[model samples]
Target: MLEIELLGVKMKNPTMLAAGVMGSTAASLNWVSCSGAGAVVTKSFSKMPNKGYKNPTTVEVTGGIINAIGLSSPGVETFKKELESINEEVPKIASIYGASPEEFSQVAGEIEQIVDLIELNISCPHAMSGCGAAIGQDPQLTFDVVEAVKKSVSVPILVKLTPNVTDLPEIALNAQKAGCDGLTLINSLGPGMKIDLETGRPILSNRFGGMSGPAIKPIAIRCVFETYAVADVPLIGVGGISNYHDVVEFLYAGASAVQIGTAIMNHGPEIFAQICQGLEKFMEEHGFQSVNEMVGLAHQF
Candidate 1:
Protein backbone atom coordinates (compact mmCIF):
# COMPACT_ATOMS: atom_id res chain seq x y z
CA MET A 1 0.00 0.00 0.00
CA LEU A 2 2.94 2.34 0.58
CA GLU A 3 4.70 1.67 -2.71
CA ILE A 4 6.32 4.74 -4.28
CA GLU A 5 8.24 5.42 -7.47
CA LEU A 6 10.58 8.37 -6.98
CA LEU A 7 12.35 9.67 -10.08
CA GLY A 8 11.90 6.27 -11.77
CA VAL A 9 13.39 4.31 -8.85
CA LYS A 10 10.76 2.04 -7.38
CA MET A 11 10.47 1.50 -3.65
CA LYS A 12 8.30 -0.95 -1.68
CA ASN A 13 7.35 1.78 0.73
CA PRO A 14 7.92 5.50 1.32
CA THR A 15 10.43 5.18 4.14
CA MET A 16 14.08 5.95 3.42
CA LEU A 17 17.04 5.82 5.82
CA ALA A 18 18.26 9.38 5.84
CA ALA A 19 21.93 10.13 5.23
CA GLY A 20 24.31 10.31 8.26
CA VAL A 21 22.51 7.74 10.37
CA MET A 22 24.10 4.29 10.25
CA GLY A 23 24.95 5.05 6.66
CA SER A 24 28.74 4.98 6.72
CA THR A 25 29.08 1.40 5.51
CA ALA A 26 27.50 -1.34 3.41
CA ALA A 27 26.68 -3.50 6.40
CA SER A 28 24.58 -0.83 8.07
CA LEU A 29 22.84 0.20 4.85
CA ASN A 30 21.97 -3.45 4.18
CA TRP A 31 20.75 -3.80 7.75
CA VAL A 32 18.39 -0.81 7.38
CA SER A 33 17.02 -2.22 4.13
CA CYS A 34 16.57 -5.62 5.76
CA SER A 35 14.84 -3.89 8.63
CA GLY A 36 12.23 -2.62 6.10
CA ALA A 37 13.43 0.80 4.98
CA GLY A 38 12.47 1.07 1.31
CA ALA A 39 15.71 2.81 0.40
CA VAL A 40 18.88 4.07 2.11
CA VAL A 41 21.23 7.05 1.73
CA THR A 42 24.90 6.72 2.50
CA LYS A 43 26.76 9.15 4.71
CA SER A 44 27.78 12.33 2.90
CA PHE A 45 31.22 11.89 1.37
CA SER A 46 33.58 14.22 -0.44
CA LYS A 47 36.08 13.97 -3.28
CA MET A 48 38.85 13.89 -0.66
CA PRO A 49 38.96 12.33 2.77
CA ASN A 50 37.95 14.49 5.73
CA LYS A 51 38.52 13.51 9.37
CA GLY A 52 36.04 16.14 10.53
CA TYR A 53 35.86 17.34 14.15
CA LYS A 54 37.51 15.67 17.12
CA ASN A 55 35.90 13.88 20.06
CA PRO A 56 32.64 14.98 21.71
CA THR A 57 30.88 15.33 18.41
CA THR A 58 27.32 14.86 19.64
CA VAL A 59 25.45 15.91 22.75
CA GLU A 60 21.90 15.66 24.09
CA VAL A 61 19.93 18.88 24.13
CA THR A 62 16.48 19.82 25.34
CA GLY A 63 14.66 18.87 22.12
CA GLY A 64 17.14 16.66 20.32
CA ILE A 65 20.80 15.91 19.84
CA ILE A 66 23.26 18.41 18.37
CA ASN A 67 26.18 17.07 16.39
CA ALA A 68 29.18 18.49 14.60
CA ILE A 69 30.87 15.50 13.06
CA GLY A 70 32.33 17.91 10.48
CA LEU A 71 31.07 15.77 7.61
CA SER A 72 34.04 13.46 8.05
CA SER A 73 34.40 11.09 5.14
CA PRO A 74 36.92 8.58 3.89
CA GLY A 75 36.75 10.15 0.41
CA VAL A 76 34.94 8.96 -2.72
CA GLU A 77 37.40 6.27 -3.77
CA THR A 78 37.08 4.47 -0.45
CA PHE A 79 33.33 5.06 -0.14
CA LYS A 80 32.84 3.47 -3.57
CA LYS A 81 34.15 0.23 -2.11
CA GLU A 82 31.47 0.23 0.56
CA LEU A 83 28.77 1.17 -1.93
CA GLU A 84 29.70 -1.75 -4.19
CA SER A 85 29.35 -4.14 -1.26
CA ILE A 86 25.70 -3.36 -0.46
CA ASN A 87 23.61 -6.46 -1.30
CA GLU A 88 20.13 -5.21 -0.64
CA GLU A 89 17.18 -5.11 -3.04
CA VAL A 90 16.24 -1.53 -2.26
CA PRO A 91 17.43 1.53 -4.08
CA LYS A 92 20.66 3.00 -2.73
CA ILE A 93 21.32 6.76 -2.71
CA ALA A 94 24.77 8.28 -2.41
CA SER A 95 24.89 11.47 -0.38
CA ILE A 96 27.75 13.65 -1.61
CA TYR A 97 29.08 17.12 -0.88
CA GLY A 98 31.89 19.36 -2.12
CA ALA A 99 33.32 22.84 -1.85
CA SER A 100 32.69 23.60 -5.51
CA PRO A 101 30.56 22.55 -8.47
CA GLU A 102 33.39 20.70 -10.18
CA GLU A 103 34.15 18.77 -7.03
CA PHE A 104 30.48 17.88 -6.60
CA SER A 105 30.29 16.74 -10.22
CA GLN A 106 33.41 14.64 -9.93
CA VAL A 107 32.11 12.76 -6.90
CA ALA A 108 28.64 12.21 -8.38
CA GLY A 109 30.05 11.06 -11.73
CA GLU A 110 32.27 8.45 -10.15
CA ILE A 111 29.50 6.84 -8.09
CA GLU A 112 26.56 7.24 -10.46
CA GLN A 113 26.90 3.69 -11.74
CA ILE A 114 26.84 2.18 -8.27
CA VAL A 115 23.74 3.84 -6.87
CA ASP A 116 20.18 4.49 -8.02
CA LEU A 117 20.21 8.12 -6.90
CA ILE A 118 22.57 10.89 -5.77
CA GLU A 119 21.64 13.21 -2.93
CA LEU A 120 23.62 16.46 -2.93
CA ASN A 121 24.10 17.14 0.76
CA ILE A 122 24.52 20.89 0.51
CA SER A 123 22.83 21.52 3.82
CA CYS A 124 24.95 20.00 6.53
CA PRO A 125 25.02 22.70 9.18
CA HIS A 126 28.38 21.73 10.62
CA ALA A 127 30.33 20.96 7.48
CA MET A 128 33.95 22.02 7.47
CA SER A 129 35.64 24.15 4.80
CA GLY A 130 33.19 25.44 2.15
CA CYS A 131 31.15 22.29 1.64
CA GLY A 132 27.80 22.29 3.39
CA ALA A 133 25.20 24.98 4.03
CA ALA A 134 27.41 27.49 2.31
CA ILE A 135 26.43 26.06 -1.07
CA GLY A 136 22.78 25.53 -0.21
CA GLN A 137 22.20 28.96 1.26
CA ASP A 138 22.87 30.69 -2.04
CA PRO A 139 20.43 30.22 -4.93
CA GLN A 140 23.12 30.64 -7.57
CA LEU A 141 25.44 28.18 -5.88
CA THR A 142 22.62 25.67 -5.55
CA PHE A 143 21.93 25.95 -9.26
CA ASP A 144 25.57 25.67 -10.20
CA VAL A 145 26.16 22.55 -8.14
CA VAL A 146 22.95 20.86 -9.26
CA GLU A 147 23.58 21.71 -12.89
CA ALA A 148 27.13 20.45 -12.69
CA VAL A 149 26.10 17.15 -11.11
CA LYS A 150 23.25 16.72 -13.59
CA LYS A 151 25.70 17.09 -16.48
CA SER A 152 28.00 14.50 -14.96
CA VAL A 153 25.62 11.74 -13.90
CA SER A 154 22.66 9.88 -15.40
CA VAL A 155 21.22 8.98 -12.01
CA PRO A 156 18.42 11.05 -10.52
CA ILE A 157 19.62 13.77 -8.14
CA LEU A 158 18.05 15.19 -5.01
CA VAL A 159 19.42 18.35 -3.36
CA LYS A 160 19.19 18.08 0.41
CA LEU A 161 18.59 21.69 1.51
CA THR A 162 19.10 23.57 4.73
CA PRO A 163 16.25 25.01 6.76
CA ASN A 164 18.61 27.67 8.04
CA VAL A 165 18.11 29.71 4.88
CA THR A 166 15.96 32.81 4.84
CA ASP A 167 14.66 32.27 1.32
CA LEU A 168 14.22 28.52 1.08
CA PRO A 169 11.71 28.52 -1.77
CA GLU A 170 14.07 30.58 -3.87
CA ILE A 171 16.79 28.01 -3.34
CA ALA A 172 14.44 25.12 -4.12
CA LEU A 173 13.29 26.77 -7.35
CA ASN A 174 16.87 27.28 -8.44
CA ALA A 175 17.66 23.59 -7.98
CA GLN A 176 14.63 22.65 -10.09
CA LYS A 177 15.71 25.01 -12.83
CA ALA A 178 19.15 23.46 -12.71
CA GLY A 179 17.69 19.99 -13.44
CA CYS A 180 17.53 18.22 -10.09
CA ASP A 181 15.03 15.36 -10.28
CA GLY A 182 13.81 15.90 -6.73
CA LEU A 183 14.52 17.69 -3.45
CA THR A 184 15.07 16.70 0.17
CA LEU A 185 13.91 19.34 2.57
CA ILE A 186 15.19 20.63 5.92
CA ASN A 187 18.53 18.96 6.68
CA SER A 188 18.48 19.38 10.44
CA LEU A 189 18.18 22.77 12.19
CA GLY A 190 20.22 25.12 14.32
CA PRO A 191 23.93 24.71 14.45
CA GLY A 192 22.43 24.63 17.92
CA MET A 193 24.55 23.95 20.97
CA LYS A 194 24.48 22.74 24.55
CA ILE A 195 26.63 23.87 27.48
CA ASP A 196 27.84 21.67 30.33
CA LEU A 197 26.94 23.17 33.67
CA GLU A 198 29.63 21.35 35.56
CA THR A 199 32.47 21.82 33.13
CA GLY A 200 31.37 25.28 32.00
CA ARG A 201 32.13 24.35 28.42
CA PRO A 202 30.35 23.41 25.21
CA ILE A 203 29.44 19.75 25.04
CA LEU A 204 30.33 19.24 21.40
CA SER A 205 33.94 19.77 20.41
CA ASN A 206 32.75 22.05 17.62
CA ARG A 207 30.68 24.10 20.05
CA PHE A 208 27.60 24.05 17.79
CA GLY A 209 26.03 21.59 15.39
CA GLY A 210 22.87 20.72 13.55
CA MET A 211 19.84 19.78 15.62
CA SER A 212 17.63 16.82 14.78
CA GLY A 213 14.70 15.10 16.51
CA PRO A 214 10.96 15.51 17.22
CA ALA A 215 11.37 19.25 17.73
CA ILE A 216 12.28 20.00 14.12
CA LYS A 217 9.26 18.33 12.49
CA PRO A 218 7.03 21.37 12.32
CA ILE A 219 9.71 23.45 10.63
CA ALA A 220 10.48 20.61 8.24
CA ILE A 221 6.83 20.30 7.34
CA ARG A 222 6.67 24.02 6.77
CA CYS A 223 9.67 23.92 4.47
CA VAL A 224 8.16 21.07 2.44
CA PHE A 225 4.79 22.75 2.30
CA GLU A 226 6.32 26.02 1.19
CA THR A 227 8.69 24.49 -1.32
CA TYR A 228 5.95 22.34 -2.83
CA ALA A 229 3.95 25.45 -3.48
CA VAL A 230 6.72 26.84 -5.67
CA ALA A 231 8.57 23.93 -7.27
CA ASP A 232 7.47 21.16 -9.61
CA VAL A 233 10.04 18.55 -8.62
CA PRO A 234 9.20 15.90 -6.03
CA LEU A 235 10.33 16.29 -2.41
CA ILE A 236 11.69 13.76 0.09
CA GLY A 237 10.74 15.01 3.55
CA VAL A 238 13.19 14.56 6.46
CA GLY A 239 14.14 16.02 9.82
CA GLY A 240 12.70 14.61 13.04
CA ILE A 241 10.37 11.92 11.72
CA SER A 242 9.93 9.16 14.33
CA ASN A 243 6.58 7.58 13.58
CA TYR A 244 4.01 6.77 10.92
CA HIS A 245 2.01 9.76 12.01
CA ASP A 246 4.98 11.99 11.23
CA VAL A 247 5.21 10.42 7.78
CA VAL A 248 1.54 11.08 7.13
CA GLU A 249 1.91 14.71 8.17
CA PHE A 250 4.81 15.14 5.78
CA LEU A 251 2.80 13.64 2.91
CA TYR A 252 -0.09 15.93 3.66
CA ALA A 253 2.39 18.79 3.76
CA GLY A 254 3.58 17.79 0.26
CA ALA A 255 6.32 15.20 0.60
CA SER A 256 6.43 12.45 -2.00
CA ALA A 257 8.37 10.31 0.48
CA VAL A 258 9.76 10.52 3.98
CA GLN A 259 13.24 9.81 5.43
CA ILE A 260 14.02 8.72 8.99
CA GLY A 261 17.26 9.74 10.75
CA THR A 262 17.48 10.91 14.36
CA ALA A 263 14.65 8.62 15.30
CA ILE A 264 16.91 5.75 14.29
CA MET A 265 19.21 6.72 17.14
CA ASN A 266 16.38 5.99 19.55
CA HIS A 267 14.56 3.16 17.75
CA GLY A 268 17.31 1.40 15.83
CA PRO A 269 16.80 0.05 12.29
CA GLU A 270 13.65 -1.70 13.51
CA ILE A 271 11.97 1.70 13.41
CA PHE A 272 11.51 1.17 9.69
CA ALA A 273 9.34 -1.92 10.18
CA GLN A 274 7.41 -0.40 13.04
CA ILE A 275 6.74 2.73 11.02
CA CYS A 276 5.78 0.76 7.91
CA GLN A 277 3.36 -1.38 9.83
CA GLY A 278 1.86 1.64 11.48
CA LEU A 279 1.65 3.44 8.13
CA GLU A 280 -0.16 0.49 6.57
CA LYS A 281 -2.69 0.38 9.38
CA PHE A 282 -3.14 4.12 9.22
CA MET A 283 -3.73 3.94 5.47
CA GLU A 284 -6.32 1.23 5.86
CA GLU A 285 -8.27 3.10 8.49
CA HIS A 286 -8.11 6.38 6.62
CA GLY A 287 -9.18 4.95 3.22
CA PHE A 288 -5.91 5.95 1.61
CA GLN A 289 -4.99 3.28 -0.91
CA SER A 290 -1.54 4.54 -1.80
CA VAL A 291 1.10 6.92 -0.54
CA ASN A 292 0.64 9.13 -3.61
CA GLU A 293 -2.94 9.84 -2.61
CA MET A 294 -1.75 11.57 0.53
CA VAL A 295 0.86 13.88 -0.99
CA GLY A 296 0.14 17.60 -0.82
CA LEU A 297 -3.28 17.20 0.80
CA ALA A 298 -2.72 20.34 2.84
CA HIS A 299 -2.05 22.47 -0.24
CA GLN A 300 -5.64 22.06 -1.26
CA PHE A 301 -6.79 24.06 1.68
Candidate 2:
Protein backbone atom coordinates (compact mmCIF):
# COMPACT_ATOMS: atom_id res chain seq x y z
CA MET A 1 0.00 0.00 0.00
CA LEU A 2 2.93 2.29 0.64
CA GLU A 3 4.79 1.58 -2.56
CA ILE A 4 5.88 4.61 -4.62
CA GLU A 5 8.41 5.57 -7.25
CA LEU A 6 10.67 8.62 -7.18
CA LEU A 7 12.04 9.70 -10.56
CA GLY A 8 11.58 6.18 -12.00
CA VAL A 9 13.35 4.43 -9.11
CA LYS A 10 10.98 1.96 -7.47
CA MET A 11 10.66 2.06 -3.72
CA LYS A 12 9.16 -0.89 -1.84
CA ASN A 13 7.69 1.72 0.51
CA PRO A 14 7.77 5.48 1.07
CA THR A 15 10.38 5.35 3.80
CA MET A 16 13.97 6.26 2.93
CA LEU A 17 17.06 6.53 5.11
CA ALA A 18 17.87 10.23 5.15
CA ALA A 19 21.30 11.48 4.18
CA GLY A 20 23.98 12.14 6.87
CA VAL A 21 22.70 9.42 9.13
CA MET A 22 24.11 5.88 8.86
CA GLY A 23 24.64 6.62 5.15
CA SER A 24 28.40 7.00 4.94
CA THR A 25 29.34 3.42 4.24
CA ALA A 26 28.19 0.31 2.40
CA ALA A 27 27.75 -1.69 5.58
CA SER A 28 25.52 0.84 7.32
CA LEU A 29 23.45 1.52 4.19
CA ASN A 30 23.07 -2.21 3.51
CA TRP A 31 21.94 -2.71 7.09
CA VAL A 32 19.24 -0.07 6.62
CA SER A 33 18.06 -1.66 3.34
CA CYS A 34 18.05 -5.10 4.94
CA SER A 35 16.05 -3.65 7.81
CA GLY A 36 13.30 -2.64 5.33
CA ALA A 37 14.04 0.86 4.09
CA GLY A 38 12.61 1.38 0.63
CA ALA A 39 15.85 3.05 -0.41
CA VAL A 40 19.12 4.42 0.99
CA VAL A 41 20.81 7.76 0.31
CA THR A 42 24.49 7.97 1.10
CA LYS A 43 25.93 10.77 3.20
CA SER A 44 26.76 13.88 1.21
CA PHE A 45 30.20 13.64 -0.37
CA SER A 46 32.19 16.07 -2.48
CA LYS A 47 34.86 16.23 -5.17
CA MET A 48 37.58 16.31 -2.51
CA PRO A 49 38.12 14.81 0.95
CA ASN A 50 36.74 16.62 3.96
CA LYS A 51 37.64 15.82 7.57
CA GLY A 52 34.52 17.68 8.74
CA TYR A 53 34.23 19.30 12.14
CA LYS A 54 36.15 18.42 15.29
CA ASN A 55 35.38 16.05 18.21
CA PRO A 56 32.36 18.03 19.43
CA THR A 57 30.55 17.77 16.12
CA THR A 58 27.22 16.95 17.74
CA VAL A 59 25.43 18.02 20.91
CA GLU A 60 21.87 17.40 22.03
CA VAL A 61 19.32 20.09 22.71
CA THR A 62 15.73 20.08 23.92
CA GLY A 63 14.12 18.84 20.69
CA GLY A 64 17.08 17.60 18.65
CA ILE A 65 20.82 17.62 18.23
CA ILE A 66 22.85 20.50 16.84
CA ASN A 67 25.63 19.33 14.57
CA ALA A 68 28.53 20.78 12.60
CA ILE A 69 29.87 17.75 10.81
CA GLY A 70 31.38 19.99 8.10
CA LEU A 71 30.18 17.71 5.26
CA SER A 72 33.09 15.37 5.79
CA SER A 73 33.58 13.09 2.83
CA PRO A 74 36.07 10.64 1.33
CA GLY A 75 35.77 12.50 -2.01
CA VAL A 76 34.21 11.06 -5.17
CA GLU A 77 36.98 8.67 -6.25
CA THR A 78 37.14 6.86 -2.92
CA PHE A 79 33.37 6.96 -2.34
CA LYS A 80 32.77 5.10 -5.62
CA LYS A 81 33.95 1.87 -4.02
CA GLU A 82 31.34 2.09 -1.28
CA LEU A 83 28.57 2.95 -3.77
CA GLU A 84 29.53 0.03 -6.02
CA SER A 85 29.30 -2.27 -3.03
CA ILE A 86 25.69 -1.43 -2.11
CA ASN A 87 23.32 -4.42 -2.19
CA GLU A 88 21.26 -4.94 -5.32
CA GLU A 89 17.87 -5.02 -3.62
CA VAL A 90 18.23 -1.48 -2.34
CA PRO A 91 18.06 1.49 -4.67
CA LYS A 92 21.16 3.56 -4.01
CA ILE A 93 21.17 7.38 -4.15
CA ALA A 94 24.45 9.21 -4.02
CA SER A 95 24.21 12.58 -2.25
CA ILE A 96 26.96 14.88 -3.48
CA TYR A 97 28.08 18.51 -3.01
CA GLY A 98 30.56 20.91 -4.60
CA ALA A 99 31.62 24.54 -4.44
CA SER A 100 30.67 25.31 -8.02
CA PRO A 101 28.48 24.03 -10.85
CA GLU A 102 31.56 22.58 -12.49
CA GLU A 103 32.60 20.72 -9.36
CA PHE A 104 29.08 19.41 -8.81
CA SER A 105 29.03 18.10 -12.37
CA GLN A 106 32.44 16.49 -11.93
CA VAL A 107 31.39 14.64 -8.77
CA ALA A 108 28.10 13.59 -10.37
CA GLY A 109 29.97 12.20 -13.35
CA GLU A 110 32.20 10.16 -11.07
CA ILE A 111 29.32 8.37 -9.26
CA GLU A 112 26.38 8.65 -11.68
CA GLN A 113 26.77 5.13 -13.05
CA ILE A 114 27.18 3.54 -9.64
CA VAL A 115 23.98 4.85 -8.08
CA ASP A 116 20.38 5.18 -9.11
CA LEU A 117 20.06 8.93 -8.45
CA ILE A 118 22.03 12.04 -7.57
CA GLU A 119 20.85 14.33 -4.72
CA LEU A 120 22.41 17.75 -4.92
CA ASN A 121 23.56 18.70 -1.41
CA ILE A 122 23.64 22.46 -1.70
CA SER A 123 21.80 22.77 1.59
CA CYS A 124 24.13 21.56 4.32
CA PRO A 125 23.77 24.08 7.15
CA HIS A 126 27.25 23.62 8.55
CA ALA A 127 29.12 22.80 5.38
CA MET A 128 32.49 24.38 4.94
CA SER A 129 32.75 28.13 4.16
CA GLY A 130 32.20 28.06 0.42
CA CYS A 131 30.41 24.83 -0.60
CA GLY A 132 27.38 24.41 1.63
CA ALA A 133 24.06 26.26 1.98
CA ALA A 134 25.56 29.16 0.11
CA ILE A 135 25.00 27.34 -3.14
CA GLY A 136 21.41 26.46 -2.27
CA GLN A 137 20.41 29.88 -0.97
CA ASP A 138 21.21 31.49 -4.29
CA PRO A 139 18.72 31.08 -7.13
CA GLN A 140 21.15 31.41 -10.02
CA LEU A 141 23.65 29.04 -8.51
CA THR A 142 20.98 26.47 -7.71
CA PHE A 143 19.91 26.56 -11.37
CA ASP A 144 23.44 26.38 -12.60
CA VAL A 145 24.24 23.36 -10.43
CA VAL A 146 21.01 21.60 -11.31
CA GLU A 147 21.40 22.34 -15.00
CA ALA A 148 25.03 21.29 -14.98
CA VAL A 149 24.30 18.02 -13.20
CA LYS A 150 21.34 17.36 -15.46
CA LYS A 151 23.64 17.76 -18.42
CA SER A 152 26.38 15.60 -16.88
CA VAL A 153 24.44 12.51 -15.79
CA SER A 154 21.76 10.22 -17.15
CA VAL A 155 20.66 9.32 -13.63
CA PRO A 156 17.74 11.33 -12.23
CA ILE A 157 18.77 14.45 -10.31
CA LEU A 158 17.05 15.73 -7.17
CA VAL A 159 17.93 19.09 -5.64
CA LYS A 160 17.75 19.21 -1.86
CA LEU A 161 16.68 22.73 -0.78
CA THR A 162 17.30 24.66 2.41
CA PRO A 163 14.47 25.86 4.64
CA ASN A 164 16.61 28.79 5.72
CA VAL A 165 15.56 30.65 2.60
CA THR A 166 13.06 33.47 2.77
CA ASP A 167 11.57 32.36 -0.53
CA LEU A 168 11.81 28.58 -0.92
CA PRO A 169 9.30 28.18 -3.75
CA GLU A 170 11.27 30.58 -5.87
CA ILE A 171 14.31 28.36 -5.60
CA ALA A 172 12.21 25.21 -5.99
CA LEU A 173 10.68 26.58 -9.16
CA ASN A 174 14.08 27.66 -10.41
CA ALA A 175 15.38 24.14 -9.88
CA GLN A 176 12.46 22.68 -11.82
CA LYS A 177 13.04 25.21 -14.55
CA ALA A 178 16.62 24.01 -14.72
CA GLY A 179 15.25 20.51 -15.42
CA CYS A 180 15.79 18.82 -12.05
CA ASP A 181 13.87 15.56 -11.79
CA GLY A 182 12.57 16.15 -8.23
CA LEU A 183 13.14 17.86 -4.90
CA THR A 184 14.08 17.02 -1.29
CA LEU A 185 12.84 19.45 1.25
CA ILE A 186 14.47 21.10 4.28
CA ASN A 187 18.01 19.77 4.80
CA SER A 188 17.86 20.64 8.52
CA LEU A 189 16.20 23.52 10.36
CA GLY A 190 18.72 25.94 11.82
CA PRO A 191 22.28 26.70 12.72
CA GLY A 192 20.97 26.45 16.28
CA MET A 193 23.22 25.70 19.24
CA LYS A 194 23.17 24.37 22.78
CA ILE A 195 25.23 26.33 25.24
CA ASP A 196 27.21 24.80 28.10
CA LEU A 197 25.63 26.06 31.29
CA GLU A 198 28.75 25.61 33.35
CA THR A 199 31.23 26.99 30.84
CA GLY A 200 28.73 29.39 29.27
CA ARG A 201 30.07 28.39 25.88
CA PRO A 202 28.62 26.70 22.80
CA ILE A 203 28.81 22.91 22.98
CA LEU A 204 29.36 22.07 19.32
CA SER A 205 32.83 22.25 17.83
CA ASN A 206 31.63 24.67 15.15
CA ARG A 207 29.49 26.60 17.65
CA PHE A 208 26.26 26.07 15.68
CA GLY A 209 24.68 23.67 13.20
CA GLY A 210 21.44 22.54 11.63
CA MET A 211 18.71 21.30 13.99
CA SER A 212 16.97 17.98 13.41
CA GLY A 213 14.40 15.80 15.24
CA PRO A 214 10.80 16.50 16.30
CA ALA A 215 11.59 20.17 16.45
CA ILE A 216 11.98 20.58 12.71
CA LYS A 217 9.07 18.45 11.49
CA PRO A 218 6.61 21.28 11.19
CA ILE A 219 9.01 23.39 9.18
CA ALA A 220 9.80 20.47 6.91
CA ILE A 221 6.10 19.83 6.38
CA ARG A 222 5.55 23.46 5.57
CA CYS A 223 8.35 23.41 3.01
CA VAL A 224 6.92 20.38 1.24
CA PHE A 225 3.47 21.86 1.36
CA GLU A 226 4.55 25.16 -0.15
CA THR A 227 6.88 23.62 -2.69
CA TYR A 228 4.28 21.14 -3.93
CA ALA A 229 1.88 24.00 -4.57
CA VAL A 230 4.11 25.40 -7.31
CA ALA A 231 6.68 22.77 -8.21
CA ASP A 232 6.30 20.57 -11.25
CA VAL A 233 8.56 17.90 -9.73
CA PRO A 234 7.98 15.49 -6.85
CA LEU A 235 9.30 16.05 -3.32
CA ILE A 236 11.10 13.85 -0.79
CA GLY A 237 10.52 15.09 2.73
CA VAL A 238 13.21 14.96 5.46
CA GLY A 239 13.41 16.27 8.99
CA GLY A 240 12.16 15.26 12.44
CA ILE A 241 10.32 12.08 11.36
CA SER A 242 10.27 9.67 14.31
CA ASN A 243 7.15 7.58 13.76
CA TYR A 244 4.76 6.27 11.17
CA HIS A 245 2.43 9.12 12.08
CA ASP A 246 5.16 11.58 11.09
CA VAL A 247 5.40 9.93 7.69
CA VAL A 248 1.62 10.21 7.31
CA GLU A 249 1.80 13.88 8.20
CA PHE A 250 4.43 14.48 5.56
CA LEU A 251 2.32 12.66 2.99
CA TYR A 252 -0.69 14.72 3.97
CA ALA A 253 1.42 17.83 3.64
CA GLY A 254 2.29 16.98 0.00
CA ALA A 255 5.47 14.94 0.25
CA SER A 256 5.58 12.11 -2.30
CA ALA A 257 7.88 10.32 0.15
CA VAL A 258 9.64 10.98 3.44
CA GLN A 259 13.12 10.36 4.89
CA ILE A 260 14.09 9.52 8.49
CA GLY A 261 17.38 10.65 10.01
CA THR A 262 17.52 11.71 13.65
CA ALA A 263 14.96 9.02 14.39
CA ILE A 264 17.53 6.44 13.29
CA MET A 265 20.04 7.84 15.76
CA ASN A 266 17.65 6.91 18.53
CA HIS A 267 15.75 3.90 17.15
CA GLY A 268 18.36 2.09 15.01
CA PRO A 269 17.73 0.45 11.61
CA GLU A 270 14.87 -1.67 12.91
CA ILE A 271 12.82 1.49 12.99
CA PHE A 272 12.34 1.13 9.23
CA ALA A 273 10.47 -2.18 9.52
CA GLN A 274 8.52 -0.98 12.53
CA ILE A 275 7.47 2.20 10.77
CA CYS A 276 6.58 0.35 7.56
CA GLN A 277 4.32 -2.03 9.48
CA GLY A 278 2.70 0.89 11.22
CA LEU A 279 2.35 2.80 7.94
CA GLU A 280 0.75 -0.21 6.26
CA LYS A 281 -1.77 -0.43 9.05
CA PHE A 282 -2.31 3.33 8.92
CA MET A 283 -3.12 3.34 5.18
CA GLU A 284 -5.57 0.48 5.60
CA GLU A 285 -7.25 2.06 8.60
CA HIS A 286 -7.50 5.48 6.95
CA GLY A 287 -8.63 4.13 3.60
CA PHE A 288 -5.58 5.35 1.79
CA GLN A 289 -5.66 3.24 -1.38
CA SER A 290 -2.21 4.37 -2.39
CA VAL A 291 0.57 6.59 -1.19
CA ASN A 292 -0.21 8.84 -4.16
CA GLU A 293 -3.76 9.24 -2.89
CA MET A 294 -2.41 10.62 0.39
CA VAL A 295 0.02 13.17 -1.02
CA GLY A 296 -1.05 16.82 -0.66
CA LEU A 297 -4.30 16.03 1.18
CA ALA A 298 -3.68 18.93 3.49
CA HIS A 299 -4.24 21.31 0.60
CA GLN A 300 -7.85 20.25 0.58
CA PHE A 301 -8.16 21.40 4.16
Clashing pairs in 2: none
Q: Write the per-residue lDDT of candidate 2 for residues 1-301, one digit (tens) a residue.
A: 7788888999999999999999999999999999999999999999999898887998888888888899999998889999989999899999999989999999999888788988999898888786656888999999999999899889999999999999999999999999999999989878898889999998888888999999988899999999989998889999999999999999888899888999888999999999999999988998888899988999986
Give me the overall lDDT of model 1: 0.93
lDDT of 1 at 171: 95
lDDT of 1 by residue, 1-301 (tens): 8899999999999999999999999999999999999999999999999999998999877767899999999999999999999975889999999999999999998999999999999988888876655899899999999999999888999999999999999999999999999999889898898889999998889998999999999999999999999999999999889999999999999999999999999889999999999999999999999999999999988
**lDDT on C-alpha atoms for all candidate structures:** 0.93, 0.90
Model 2 deviation from native, Cα RMSD in Å: 0.9
lDDT of 1 at 185: 89
Return the lDDT, model 2, position 131.
68
| Over 4 Å off, model 2 | none
